[model samples]
Target: MNLKTYQAQTMAQALAAVRRELGKDAVILHTRTFRKGGFLGLGSKNVVEITATSGVNVLHPTEKRELLNPSSVRRNSHTQMERKISPMPPRSALEPSGPAGRDHSESISSTNRSVSSKDYLQQELKLVKQMVQELLQQNRKQQHPSVPEELFSAYMGLINQEVTRELANEVIEKVRSQLGPSQIMDDIKVRELVAETLTKMLPAAEPITLETTGKSKIIALVGPTGVGKTTTIAKLAANFKLRENKAVGLITIDTYRIAAVDQLRTYANIINVPLRVVLSPEELRQAIDSMPNMDLILIDTAGRSQNDDLKLHELKSFLHAAAPDEIHLVLSTTANQSVLLSTIKRFSSLNIDHIIFTKLDEAVGVGMLFGVMKKLNRAVSYITTGQNVPEDIEPGSVGRLARMIVHPQKGSEISDDNIPSIAAGEIL
Candidate 1:
């Protein structure tokens, strides 16, 4: 194929010119705008440039056809790109020609070479994708998969289902331990494996219960901004009240996030539970002690960044003041595994008892959770699947959690639109 240049002031004009001269199927090798060139006409100044390369199957002899010819195709050639090609063979030769004995042999050899090259690329792509998946899986194993099944599954679903392959066999060729198929490309099986992986990543659910049921234990739900801490708190409170028939008290220290207090207070009112918003550690202490008759006190703290030492310090102070019997660290499944692991480690010093995975009805990616639960050596207590109060929260059961892990997404392909957020909201 001859290299042709299309020049026009407007990109559309340039494209039009290319199409008009080279025909619709012509390959666009390159496109550019040069501001450093001519004064006028043939010479233009620097301007916007749009470059694109496209190719088409050649029916008749062409340069690309020459390169694609089989006789010149080297048997040892690792890449099709390296093969020397002759112009496209005549249509007659494409069909079997017993008459050309030796020529026929060469044609068969050429066809085999091309086919082999294609197969290699495809296998390579599969290996590459598997490699990425395996890397993520390894991380989840290291961290231990304590994240709520839904969140992890959904995050992973995005990765697996939403991404588009721009090039031939790139992702398909990746080597990953995560992708050994029980049966290749079966969406149901893929979902099952992904779900299984998520379930494996999570630590066993170890329910935290106070031996003395005469009074309920005080628990604090804490995490970064937008992690559904407040909603989770509401769910937990409702769980204790409705399920256990225990008198639940709600405490909100989430003064930072927008409407943290009001949001929690609203939920409290809906559930007819008493709600108190405290800012200072002293007030928090007073709030805890004021409800001595309460069966259980669930404190919701402000959402703070993991790196914010000051915010963490303040939270620690509140925990000390309230003297919560348990601290459930709530983290999203979609957060970067490494960063989330570090955050959990940081919070471990505060003596967090159980882990709660909120927003389970979100993204998929069990591999991320692998790093979380394993590293902390902790068990999950509860998982919140959706935003619905009381109803969305469930005692962490392996079976139910498994369903949310990857069922919703299989071969769905992940994209930016399908990913999840890791922020926490105020618990009110």
Candidate 2:
């Protein structure tokens, strides 16, 4: 066997070296990464080391033919064995009439069938592997023609997270343009650049703010049904009242579901905050007017299906009457890009001031949020991770969101303390 070790600054380069030296038939034995060539480890550069080998006894043309056609090899062996024993039998004697002849014919038939089946499976498996490799190569070329090999993994990571192909391409192209060729070889530098590009793509996180001396900061949560708007409202109310020490009042127009009103009412009672349920726009105005002393007034509207024009119009009328300082369109991260975009488009007439993404823990990836924000051009206020009242909610941060999109595996597991605070104009 011919064994060799190859080293390069990046895995792509190392693999390229292995393929060039050992051919495609080489089997990888081991791989590792280490830092090398720096004084006292102060400026050491990371290097990828790989060990690979071509197996012993490279097959000759004849041997290769026998390996591919095992039936031919077996036939030749059987002919030689017959010649070494008694002379070859006559055709009539070989017929499956007698008991011994029948057993012999059956054994020969089974061996041939076994060999044929094994050959068919081997061919099929080989074709499938080739198809997969071709598809992967084509995908890389189609998705990222200009993307450097060193940065291809990051580009694919975004796509795997459900980021739009156009947006993912734009991000990779930006990273490639900003860094010099040598600098792009650094994995850490490429990651930071990818995060930075994604951060710039996101709208700034603008959570609701309260005025010191003015009418209460009326904020409304509106979205499609079952998106946890009521629970999110409770979370916001609890954070403001208990954490920020602000006088918060809750108003619900979700009379369609008695359970939703009762849920919010129960939360209000526990938090010692006033709760009001209003049916009509007139009563909604009366509810707001009735809470003049409150610092923040959170109005939870009934979830209106984006497809229902009548319900949307009714919800719009109530929002108009309240004249909220901010109308946050709550969206769930679990929805696909089309559903989210459609919801935003349908609700655009309501003048969505900002967005609040809920159900982060339940989502596979938050990459769709990037496409939604890019198209809507609205700022994000907050994100809800779970059903926890106050603990699951966090002020949306561009850094945290960018990180989530870049590293989806860790996105769902992020906690309050460890959440990065990279808002607009900030990076980590």
Q: Pick the candidate with the highest TM-score.
A: 2
How far does residue 316 in candidate 2 sit from its true spot (Å)? 0.8
lDDT tens digits, residues 134-216, model 2? 99989878866876787888888888888888888899999988999798888778877887898887777788777879669
Q: State which candidate has the highest lDDT.
A: 2
Q: Write the per-residue lDDT of candidate 1 for residues 176-199, one digit (tens) a residue.
A: 235555443455655555445545
Q: Candidate 2: which pairs clash?
A: 399-422
C-alpha lDDT of candidate 2 relative to the true structure: 0.75
Q: TM-score, each model?
A: 0.53, 0.69
